[model samples]
Target: MKKTNIFKIAFILTIGLASIFSSCKKDAGPAGPQGAQGAQGPQGLQGTPGPAGSTVLSGNGTPTSTTGANGDFYLDLTSSLFYGPKTAAGWGTGFAMKGANGAAGTNGNKIINGTTIPGATDGSIGDYYLNTTNYLLYGPKIASGWGVGTSLIGTANVKYSGWATSTDPINVGYGKTSIRSARINTTAITPAIINSGVVLVYARRNSDLILPGGTTPLPFSYDLSVVENIKATVNFSLGTSVIYINTTTSNNSLYAEATLEYRYVVIPGGVAIAAAKNINLNDLQAVEKYFNIEK
Candidate 1:
């Protein structure tokens, strides 16, 4: 009986310990399935761009070529260029650009031609004696009228009283002003069949010969008589002909019409007369007497 009780007590104690351990382990709930991955957050903004690379030309440049024996360099300017204004045709190689043309020469010198003694002379019509070989018995004086010549006649009568200012009657020409005067009249003047010669007339102004206004000189009429510091020269061109004229020594005196004069008038009718009396009327306008230049 004592051994049975001891065994029984041991068995009870073991059973009680097992029951306590079982209670402590209450059931672990099934593992929760992973919640759908949280929706992905919005993607971050893109990064900034890097620096630019080196420049590169896109199309082919003008064709580089050597000239042929005929001195011809043909280039087709079909390609676009950055230069302003379209290029002109027939442009040569080396591609150097050209600047605008320099301004044209000024027009102030006078041109005159006549049939009587139509050659350059040292004296004026009033003072110039006919080379005698080609003068009429009695003709007009130098200061007043023209003489016969081959191609042109020029005369200078220096009435130098004093330098006339722009406001002076001589400079502005009121009426019969007493200023020094030079006259150049181109007449197809013919000498008396008795005694006659030829003269050559050159049209020259003060030699400085600068472009008017130092810029582009357009085609226009200018009165050389009104110009300042102007001295004229006369030359004759006798192609295959000898010209002569006759004049008395009295008509060729210095300080007479032979002396350089500085006065002239704008003869509207005179220009027409000069044209009608000479060949190629278009070439004999008074404006043409001053200076003529063609672009």
Candidate 2:
């Protein structure tokens, strides 16, 4: 009687357990809340820039009678000007896109012009200094401390080229038609540039790069100088500037007969000596690079 009772009790217990499990139809309670996401990884290196598109035409010089569709455009690497929207006649006149001029960079209060030891708060890590006392420029305030200031005075002072002249000349002008000049776009000389303190620095191409008025280049050691050569003179008015090549030293020729091309640079404030010693002034490239200029 005891064995039978024990077996019956065990069977009843097992059946009760199975019924309890069966009553609960759910196998897993509604899925638990999703785990939090893991932290993201660091970013990869930046990619390089792409090349120019098909629509752009890169050439040695500016477009003249070169033909192009209405949508087509030309980039004169020599002239550094962008010309486009060509019609059936020829390439339309365009403005200068990039040149050796223009204030592509900005200098904050970092450049201390007066004579004084710049305070720590005067400028940040890369700020500059110029002690007028010594005309010593840009100590280049650094993390450790202000670096030894570089002297940009006397002979070391670089001349300025605030305004970049066109590779070509202003072909059309009214003044004394006797002067030889290049085809220069009026827009090349900005009003701000003309209005700024600047002086003239001209470059003469003895041989026309693209015109019939070219000749054997003269062997002149001083090709680029502030000194006036070839009876060259510039007349500035409003936004337009005209350079008159009155005569050529290489050959005694009349302006009407000679097809010459002139390229000039106008350094604002006459010479760059008056500019800050922090960086080279009048050079578009220097400004662009110093200020991290980009598209």
Q: Which candidate is the best by lDDT?
A: 2
lDDT of 1 at 59: 32
**lDDT tens digits, residue span 1-295, model 1:** 9999999999999999999888777754678888877888999999999864423122345533322222233333444332222223322434434556799986432334333444445344444333333222222335445433322233121011111111111112223322222323323332321133322221212322322332211121222333442322221222222211111122112121132112112223333344235333222222233222111
Candidate 1, residue 291: the lDDT equals 21
Name the runs in model 2 displaced over 4 angstroms.
1-179, 188-196, 199-247, 253-295
Model 1: ten consecutive residues of lowest lDDT: 157-166
Tens-digit lDDT track of model 2 for 1-295: 9999999999999999998898786564786899999999999999998864437677887676744555678888877778876667678687787656766676554555668645567667777876766565655678777644444544322223333334343344344323334334444355656666443333344444222233222111222123332332333233355433332232222332234333343444433433444444334334333333331
lDDT at residue 227 of model 1 (Cα atoms): 45
Global Cα RMSD, each model: 26.8, 34.1
Top candidate when judged by TM-score against the true structure? 2
TM-score of 1: 0.13
Q: Each prediction's TM-score against the native?
A: 0.13, 0.24
